[model samples]
Target: MSRKSETSGDRRPAQADALTLTGRQAARVAKRRRVMMLGLRGIPNVQGGVEKHVEMLSSRLTGHGWEVEVVGRRRYLPVSGPHLWNGVRVSPLWAPRMMALEAIIHTFLGICFAAMRRPDVLHIHAVGPALLVPLARLMRLNVVVTHHGYDYDRQKWGAFAKKMLRTGERMGMRLAHGRIAISREIAETMGERYRVPVAFVPNGVAVSHCDVETGVLGEFGLTRRRYILLAARLVPEKRQIDLIKAYAKLGNTGFNLVLAGGAEFESAYEDEVRALASRVPGVVLTGFQTGDRLAELFANAALFVLPSSHEGMPIALLEAMAHGLPVLASDIVANRQLDLPAGDYFPLGDIDALASAISEKTATSLDEQEVLAQTERVESAYSWSSVALKTLDVYRAVTK
Candidate 1:
């Protein structure tokens, strides 16, 4: 007896069914693969510390098999380009240019997009955008927030804005599925106040050994090791004007005073800083140098000074340490976390003390051993690879 031959028609249906099932599984995997980032102006050479942090973290996450997408402000990012860069995708959404409205508006739009798209994770950076954490939860989205600093403490914000920031901080810490604080101080502050468990993930830096490019020095009329560098945005809290006044009081020590950042919505403050800096001979205002120029400034400066009255974790200070420059910073809790030598810190808001520290530190060069120690500490404590790994662990914990 001959058995009925199996027909191609029956085989074709089974094969098609198997292919369809496989396609659905693959699509599900892809859908589960993405992490959506928000609350930065943009990445890939954007200005703010939050932008830089996201740029490094998001790019590194992609190498670990994450499809990272950052929601950026349209005005900050270029209008025309492929959305994907390297492995991270950038979605530039529109927002007004006004400083007060920019972050909130952009973040609202970003959160809505993440909700509609249904990304596996929605990661928001900084307390300003964390205001929407409750809303994100209501949308049934998994949320993670990184508190860069207490923005309410910043001098630029008005009373209402400051109150809103405080509310955001409270809600974000209480509501997010996972939370990251950038410094020990921040972690402690949040834990003590909000009673929430938070992870401490400090910022990272790229350690390099390039020689100080003399061309940049010449352009700014700076001599190697003859300048004191203060690189931060011109804002009242940063105390750039304090640095200028201190330098002016010191009366033209052969060393130049270099201020290496542009204005950040503080036109009046910027104008005051400029006028003060202009009055002092050898005070160079090199508005916002990045890449090689910034590196050169760090490498060649006699000393790096950050007199900020408030901070989360100062990336400027870390960059200086990476460059192996001697550093003097204000005695704030955030700066204190650096574990710097006691001699390296001046009383906060003390112009005379800052001037004295600058004079003493600049006159006395850092010992070779001290410089090596600083570089070693930076390498051990703040490498991007290590930071990325820790952050990924947080992501995995929340996702699971």
Candidate 2:
């Protein structure tokens, strides 16, 4: 019930002495919770996967009796001090970028902030933030760098930018005290390419938040009768256009296609997708819908599809399943390991096959028992409390 807001924050230099819970310790007794500073693109649900992950994780961890902090961009917050939110200590640090590219600025502030206020453990979510490893090591802080994905896979990074990200990833993994990979695919990539041992912890979802309603279909010439959901950024690897072309081949105008999520970069790719939509019917673009709105779009759908070429445990697909919409995702290793039915699997980048699969599943709906089974599985496996515990284990291993 009582609190201290560091509004400021992680170095893995030393581990704190573990404390035991006493019956008379007062149920509300605020013990010494680890000072954890999580690295993210931004915080407090800033319209991205990392932000959403942190927001949900903070609430669940705090509920589990951990003093949580949700730090994010300073520009979004009114005050420049540490503020408390839902029982977590949140320190939002801000700095002006002084470079042609924002990566240098992002990396600089992450390291500088971690250096100033050393946390019991530092969990860096963004690859850009992983560049802080040396600084964290210098501070003797236990660093747990999470490899989000191959950031340089394809976006608009020059040769130098790509090299820096790859080099940074390689170096950060080696320098950090512990490593966390969101998916086994990424973990293996780390070991094979970077030679770092990583713990696999997939992203979590809020089941309660899965309940949703949406007008995306009506707004974009789609009918509620039936449709497929493909929520992802309009980037190359996401392969949204591939879905568009495949939908054209299947030519299921009765069942519309809803493409949520905005363009990260690669404006050309987005423009191309839009152009294809102009020629093709039944393709609706709902730009960046999240929270309840995102839930509604997935909830009302006949089937959800993710035609991505690469992924590191996409929460989007998990959210779709939570909505009880049987998924028809790319047959990537990540999707395969999700332990879903074989009927849900589809070939990656094969538009005709993906579209045909969507049409075949449009008439089928998940049974109530199956929905409950999937929902319960997601709740236990990817719950924030569970994720936080796994994360703490990694921290404990490093500090010990």
Candidate 3:
């Protein structure tokens, strides 16, 4: 499909022209697997990257004839009724010790549910797999786990909590029938830290399919804006405050800087960003923009920046590239693993370098590195379709 002329400057959907077979005609198509997706969150609405990745993957794999189901905590996804989404079964966790047990009970319920479901393949999305490892083996379930990159590294965990998470994560990775990590960094980390072999499968984005509306920006008097955007959560690891400082250093040069993530669930960190955001001029903190609002924030921005100390192939970065917007990011190992366009990079904590990168982006358009390179390195390597396929391969290996 040829792209029509850009009327409003919004990037349109890329070609999704594929002939697909329906479930009614499932026997006719090549797809032949029943997969149960397990995690703490379910579909239709989810907060994190793992949930979004699984949501999109479930839709794509289902259209291709793979049976899919997602089971998550009832508190996260309401337990009122059983639901179906994009050909995936949605079941709720209902255990007595749930609220008191800090996710232990949720894992217990997940194990019981998985054993009864008897799925041909079970794809676990996080460290929850360790809790279910024994049950899955007992039930003869094919288990595959995907490492979501350093969940244990967050500041929310104290010494004991960190130690527990580390041990559990190691156990989960080791006991899985198969494991997949999103970036070379994660793959290497898992192997080096835990001595576990993990297939590298990075996340992807549908760059062109994004729909952004800056109408909300008008509410903040930032309509038709050309500001830099920082879309990550307000956590220390994400380095959001550093971006705020960079914006402060750049300081209101006809461009408005906007941040559209939530107040941290960790109140102390949230307070730090809030205090930092207050001090930065020409900077608007639109706390926690969701679906359409997030797209709008990305759409109207001149550049997208991720000043994270660490990352595992950020989806927002890919989304920015797909939207054809220039990127300015911290040069972390994970960020370097995926080949992007001629993006500006800054030293991790250097405010001067970050300001320079943002100013350079504001000054001119970034060059597009060769098309074949992007197609091979960006498009082929880290797409939802590719992730779905690699995930299916994991399923096959576990089952066999």
lDDT leader? 1
Clashes of each: 0, 16, 1
Candidate 1, superposed: residue stretches over 4 Å from native: 1-32, 79-82, 208-214
- Candidates' TM-scores? 0.91, 0.82, 0.83
lDDT of 1 at 387: 81
What is the TM-score (0 to 1) of candidate 1? Answer: 0.91
lDDT of 1 by residue, 1-400 (tens): 1233343445566444554667777565554568899989887777778988898888898888788999988877765443987789899888888989999998999899999988888999999899999889989998999999989999988999999999889888999999999998898889999898999999998854456464878988899899999988888899998888899889968999999988746578888888887788989998877777788788888999999999888888998988889899999988999898899899998999988988899888878998888898897889888888988878888888
lDDT of 2: 0.71
Candidate 1 structure lDDT: 0.86
Clashes of 1: 0
TM-score: which candidate is best?
1
Question: For model 2, what is the error of residue 400's alpha carbon versus the real structure, in angstroms, after optimal superposition?
Answer: 4.3
Candidate 3 stretches greater than 4 Å from native: 1-32, 78-80, 94-103, 128-132, 192-196, 208-214, 263-266, 340-343, 367-377
In candidate 2, position 124 carries an lDDT of 70
Q: After superposition, how far is residue 398 of candidate 1 from its true place, in Å?
A: 1.7
lDDT ranking of the models: 1, 3, 2
TM-score of 3: 0.83
